[model samples]
Target: MSELLNNSHRRKEVLMKLLMRLHEGESPDTLRTELAETLKGIPYAEVLQVEQEMISLGMPAEEVTQLCDAHSSVLSGLVDVGDAKAAPAGHPVDVFQQENKAILMTISQVRQELNTAIQSSGEDFKKSVIALRTHFNHLSDVDKHYKRKEFLVFPVLERQGLTAPPEVMWGKHDLIREQIKGIHEILLNPELTAEELQPVVDLVIEPALYALAEMVTKEEEILFPMCMDSFSENDWAQVHEHTLEYGFCIVDPVGNWKPTHTAETTAAKVESEVQSGHFQLPSGRLSAAEVQAIFNSVPFDMTFVDNEDKVKYFTQGTERIFSRNRAILGRNVLHCHPPASSNIVERILEDFRSGREERAAFWINMRGKMIHIEYFALRDEEQNYLGCLEVSQNVTRYRELEGEQRILSYGEKKSD
Candidate 1:
């Protein structure tokens, strides 16, 4: 172990020797055991340094992933040594770990099933191939999962002056994402026969599975440990609250975390103590007080655009399925969308302004809620051009309505 640690060169050289020993038909358990012991009791970043080195040395991504996972398992028991606290229920760390575990298990199962498909009979063969592709679609959730970590968790770590691991991990994440997307597309449109899937199995699917597995290890070992070391309890609490907005990859947490002191009430009390001016709605005849009430009372979100197509303002609805803060006010409407989507937004605005289209619609399902969105051109009393009105509402219940009745049937069950 001392000889293993004392080497001045990167650990990748040692790992290559160890991996070569395995390939050379030598017993690998001794070296693996030795490596694990050296990794134990070290700072998780040190372990990650070894991981990066191993990857650079032509060690299979899977082996490195396994090494990281093994390192984490060892550290899981010793985590109490640090000032780190258990991720309170629904904490980002807790949610990430739970979701990641399920994804890893699913990836493991898919890999095994595909392996069986390669060696199996006729009926089992097609079934395994289809299962592999179907699971590939499910793998998209893994990308979404990691994105949250990159955006949310990485920023917090960066603030603490630790930046290297997240960036490296994000790069590996992109590679894994591309591999999954490629495999999924191949499965969806088969340019390759089942026999040809063999290389994909080796090159794309296998490496991806290993990459995800390694990430899980790095998260549990390096990322989470470092986070726990760096973040305050309040930071975890804030993350836990935000988790509700983005949600988890696989795990559905049974409960939520609530701050001991209510930020909601404190905020409300502060707001009540402050002075706020009433707002004006697009309806020209309405009073400011009435406009405020009308906007707040409606069951939908509302936004206004001037005749020139600049986004003038948007209302803040508490039940908004998608967040829209005042920061977006007066910003170019195109800037609200992702770069890839800006052109489409501009086209819509053009059509609306030219009278080629007076309205456009779009909707999405989020967290089991179906949200309906619509944009309409608002004309004046003279029927001359004015602006566009954007309205969005949660229509989950609205879409379920059947035959309409005039009377208030109120609380009673309706017969089909």
Candidate 2:
């Protein structure tokens, strides 16, 4: 039995057969039992290989995506991770796992509150709904978690020809995102009663939470371990560097991680580029130092998304209303926003790309400050769309200005 399990060809064949059975509508419970009895444990890599092979053999990626959860459930405790590498403290994978732990804890709390709401009535149920809403809001933070994986980790995997898994996982991510959005919409009704909320809890809420938890399991047991085995130290270092842009989920990484081997850091590379030469614009030429200083000196935060929808540049203003980091440099602009907001972003991008809109503006009160944000469609001489530019500024002082001073006020003091 051990020798047969050791044979990679045979193991993958058996795994593929079981997964195909699941695709054919076999019961997950029956498959789980069969996997346990027949395979005992399958290497995590074989699981990915089998999926890739299936796709290569003419199975539509959508079909594989549809079967993702079912197969993951069937192989829940059956993936062999005995040889998985341990991530160093503060490594990207380590941080991802830590965030998963925090997400799981939040899920547990939500379940407890759900149980309370299930047995209660009237105000008590309303209170439970409020609690559930707060928990679900926290769960929405999982968007950042998924974005980091989608923008940073998945690209690296794709470059290695490990494309199918990311596609399947991204489809699952979208499904989970839609589920969370649906739950939010249902929870926002002011007239919702306990009777109305019960069906939603059973249908929408539980399923969303289950999907969220299941993805975490897939990441830790299969994805992360496989990445650790496949990626070089430098690959991890780059991932760690870019992680700050999407931000952490529930917990921040404890410390910094870098490869032991000497290599040029991102900061050092940037410095080298800055010192190399000048950037000649269509109107004027400026040294890299001058350009950097000008961007940083700008009062408003500015970000430019290229025609391809990738984040290409952002100003580094000292008092930015929104955070910016190099990690977001190549990320899709849509992925930079939460799932709830991505729809709005997509709409704006479409309008800009189609020349239907030139600009969009919005304002909100944040931490007692009124912030103004606007997006502009960039065009060339021929009116061809180049990209989108986002500008944000704190307009609290401007809004509160009583009157304009006739004279210079740089060193003037006002009397109360």
Cα lDDT listed for each candidate: 0.65, 0.84
Top-TM-score structure, candidate number: 2
Candidate 1: segments with Cα more than 4 A from true spot: 1-33, 36-84, 119-128, 244-247, 261-416
Q: How much does candidate 2 score in TM-score? A: 0.67
List candidate 2 segments past 4 Å from native: 1-6, 262-267, 271-416
Summed backbone clashes in each candidate are 0, 0
Per residue, candidate 1 scores C-alpha lDDT tens digits across 1-416 of: 77766653444455445545554555445655665665443454554455555556666665543334344433343322354456777566776777777788788889788878778756676677667755665565665577677877878877875555566677677777787778766765534466877887888778778667767776776678768767766666556545534434644554455545565454445445433434455755555656676787788988887786555666765766567653344445554554345568778788877779889999998789998989898877877778888898999987888878556777778665
Clashes of 2: 0
Models 1 onward score TM values of: 0.54, 0.67
RMSD in order of candidates = 10.4, 6.4
